[model samples]
Target: MINIFKIAARNLLRYKRRTLLTSLLITVGVVMVILFSGLSGSFKQMMIGLITDATLAQMQIHKKGYVSSIDTSPLNLNLGPKAYGKVRDMLEKNPLVESYSPRIKLGAMLSNYKETTNIRLNAIKPDSEIKVCPALPDRITFRDRESGQGLINPGEIIIPDKLAKGLKIKQGDTVVLVAHNKEGSVNGLNFTVAGVIESVAGPQGKEGYIHIKDARDLLRIDKPEVTEVAIRTRDFNRIDMLYAEINSALAEYKNPKGNPMFEIHTWEALSPFYNIARMIDLMAMSMKIIMIAIVLISILNVMMMSVYERIREIGTIAAIGTAPGKIMGLFLAEGFSLGLISTLFANAIGVGAIYILNIHKITFSFGRTENLLLSPSVNFNELIWVSAIVLLVSIFATIQPAYKASKMEPVDALRHV
Candidate 1:
């Protein structure tokens, strides 16, 4: 084994130019794959944070038909007083339920003195909203509307930063909101802009949020009419089970016609962006496959050429009683050495590049929000996984070529130039 390895090392060194070129190709392909994987992984982490922590919770409950069509016409499964009371009671009783809040959503037109723009309005309970949507605490600023005071009432409104900029409205500007109430009545309410919010969702940054009570009064919803329910769970991974249980609970409740009216949905069901994240992951895998193919081709071509060039030398060694397995081991050792060197170089380059990018605070602009594109930063576990994959691909790529070289007839090889 030692002799075979020594011969292989000597042969590689003998053809310095070809060996270096092959190693360089492998190194380049490995580095590119690692870099792209790191970037893709970072983006995925960022998206997860934006969706799970910043925006959507583990599960959401909406009117039976609201998930399919978000029409301006009154919500079909409007959770009235009885339904709200019952659902809330059921959720509180469940051990999986960490917390939940009622949300009234509407599409409305907001008008300043000079301009009007469409907006999504969310009516939320102040304390409950803060728990479910933690980003709200950092995004909104409070200021009193009267006497230029720096404090605002709980009933005051908070508009998105994008809307505030587009409408030329500021902290004290009064905006008029026009929307259909729960009873299909058209109503208008003037609200003082107490603060501005920034959100990952582009439309969210143009939407306005107000206290649920204020919204109920403005929209003239005399009875309970929450459009949706936002739910948080003790464990996000157990969301499917929780959703099933909630559905079962809701099934126990019957409408006047004796049928279930409520539908349960997980955060993944409600958010289309999560599907986009999965697609991105698929794309990253495709890229890695392509990179491996390129590296494999380069390695195979180099090994084949090396075998052809060393035909006489291989035949001489075989004729002197070197075992066939030993001959194959020589080529495999060469391939392994090349892969090991390239892997090390690639990992170093990839880690250094990621560190520099993170240090510089490189960020990508996403819709109306600009945030750090990488989350969990550069993870060591990912690096180790990628490195292992690269090594396995390298070994597999050389198997056929090495086997072919080992099977060559000594007499024929010795006769060749």
Candidate 2:
């Protein structure tokens, strides 16, 4: 084995320019793949985080048929006190649940006294809401951000930035919200604008936040019911498992109509942005395919050229009793060496580039979210797999040419020119 590799190295060194050029090509391809993977992976993760942690929690539990008519914020489909108690008890006992927030969703008329417009409202307890959606407070633009205030207090509202601007509403401005209860009773309440939240791109519109107590008073709900329970899991990667577990647990709790009473959904099911995440993943796979093609073609061309140029050498070695298997080993070793050298250089450069990106604090905006810093990184396991793929493709590409060179027989009388 050692002798075969020694011969291979000598042969590759015989064609220094060609060997270097092929290695450079593979290196460039690998580097491009690594960098693209890092950037795309970071972007996809950041977008998912924004959609899940900033807007929709990792998962949600809603009364059956609630999401289908979620656009209307149907009061009749809410989880009654008994159902809410069951859900709360289950979540509180489940180790997977990091935090959960109960919200009362409703549509209300917002009036700055001069203008009135429709707005979707999510009334929630400040403490639990912050735990479930930690990014919510960062979206507030009404008060001095430096001031350490919670999301909202009783008699306070956090309006969307667009609605605030359109209504000429400012911080501490008083707004009136008029809403109707399930019994069709109309009621209104005055609230002070505590903060303004930037509109997040999702299945939400002109949305605002208010204290849950205010929602009950405005809607005149005598019973303690909740529209939905947004939940954050301790481990995001295990969300699907937890979702299934929760669904199984809730299966026995049925409505009077003999159907399941509650439905659990992951963030992907609740947001349209999941489609974009899928597209990013597809693009990353395409990039890997392109990298494989580059490695295969570059190694194949180099090995085939080596075989043709060294045909006389092959004939001489065979005539001197070198085994065909050893001859094949020599060529395979050359291809392996080329791939290894390129992969090492590519990983070094790729990691350095990622570090530089972090150092520079590259920032860009997605949708209306701003100042998002790009922290591109590749997992160590991913790096190892990429290297293995390049090496494997290198051997696969060299097989045909190596076999051809090894199968050569001692020429007739060694008379060829």
Candidate 3:
């Protein structure tokens, strides 16, 4: 076996140019696959982080009819006080739930002298808001001008930075908010702009936030029923478990219409952009597969031609009593050796490139949002999986050609030359 390997190594070295070209092709393919996989992984991480950390929690509980009727006024499928207590209690007891926050959302139109934009006014508790959305606390300063009170209070609102600019409104300015009450009556209120917030997910600078009490008073709901429950978990990957627990708790609550009126939705379900991200990932993977197939075919063709060219040499060795199995081993070893070397070189090059790009903050932006840039990073587990996949693909690509070379008849091969 050792002698056969040495002979195979020598043969490959004798054809250094051909061997180098084949190796380069394989190396290029492997490098591309690794680089693309790294990029895709990074994009997925950024999207998940943005959704989970900045916008949506892992799971949400909403009044059953809220989602379908979101276009309508602020009518709450109101989880009554009893239901709220029950659900909040259950969430606190659930080991999987890290924290949960109550939110009331109202659809209202924000109007200044020049422009009007429809906005979803999320009513949030300042303390609980920080736990659910880590990005919110640092985003803006809600304050009262006369009393110098900070943190959003009743009749104060925070508008997204982009929306604020478009409306030509600034802090301390007044804006008109029109929304429907639970009784389906339209009501208008004037609010002082407490601050301006920056958000990547909200309507291109069109959304606004206010205190829960303010939203409740504006909508004329005396009891202030919450429209949604945002839940944070110790591990977002356990979102299914958290959803199940919350749904079970809500099962006992019935709405004003005497219908079970609470629904649980995961972040992926609530955010349409998550679906788009998934589609982009699938497309990228498919493209990588196609590229690998093309490279594999090239490698196979090169090996086959190399084998035919060396037919006389192979036959001479076989005629000198080299067993068919040993002859087969030689060709297989050559293919394996080539694949191994190429994979090593490709991984080194790919990793180096990714490292450099990440360190330099190479970015691609979308629209005016800075967070839309691609982030490139790989965790240990992903690296292991990607390396294993590359090795398996390289080995698989060598099989058919190796088998063909292994089965050639010495007499027939020699006669052909």
- The lDDT values for all models are 0.74, 0.88, 0.73
Point out the worst 10-residue segment of candidate 3 by lDDT: 199-208
Please list all clashing residue pairs in model 2, or write none if there are none: none
Off by over 4 Å in 1: 1-10, 93-97, 109-118, 141-153, 187-190, 202-205, 234-260, 371-376
Worst 10 residues of 2 by lDDT: 408-417
Please write out the lDDT profile of model 3 over residues 1-417, one tens digit for every residue: 777668767877888998888778877876777777778778777766666766676777876766776655345566667667777888888888888889887788888856788877788886676688776545565544444354577888888887787778889898999888767789888998889877665321335688887877788877747877888888877778777777777787776778886788887777766777789778767856775675567557766876878887777878888777777777777766666677778778888988987887766654354656676764556456555655566556666766766677778878974
Q: How many backbone clashes does candidate 1 have?
A: 1
Show how many residue pairs clash in every candidate, following the order shown: 1, 0, 0
Winning model by TM-score: 2
Model 3 TM:
0.86
Sort the predicted structures by lDDT, highest score first: 2, 1, 3
Query: Model 3, which residues run further than 4 Å from truth?
Result: 1-9, 111-117, 138-155, 176-178, 185-190, 202-206, 248-260, 320-322, 379-383, 414-416
Candidate 2: tens digits of C-alpha lDDT, residues 277-378: 898889878888999999999999999998887788888888899889888988999998889888999899888888888788889887766678888987
**Which lDDT value does model 3 have at 181?**
77
TM-score: model 2 vs. ground truth: 0.94
Q: Kindly give the stretch of ten consecutive residues in candidate 1 with the minimal lDDT sum.
A: 144-153
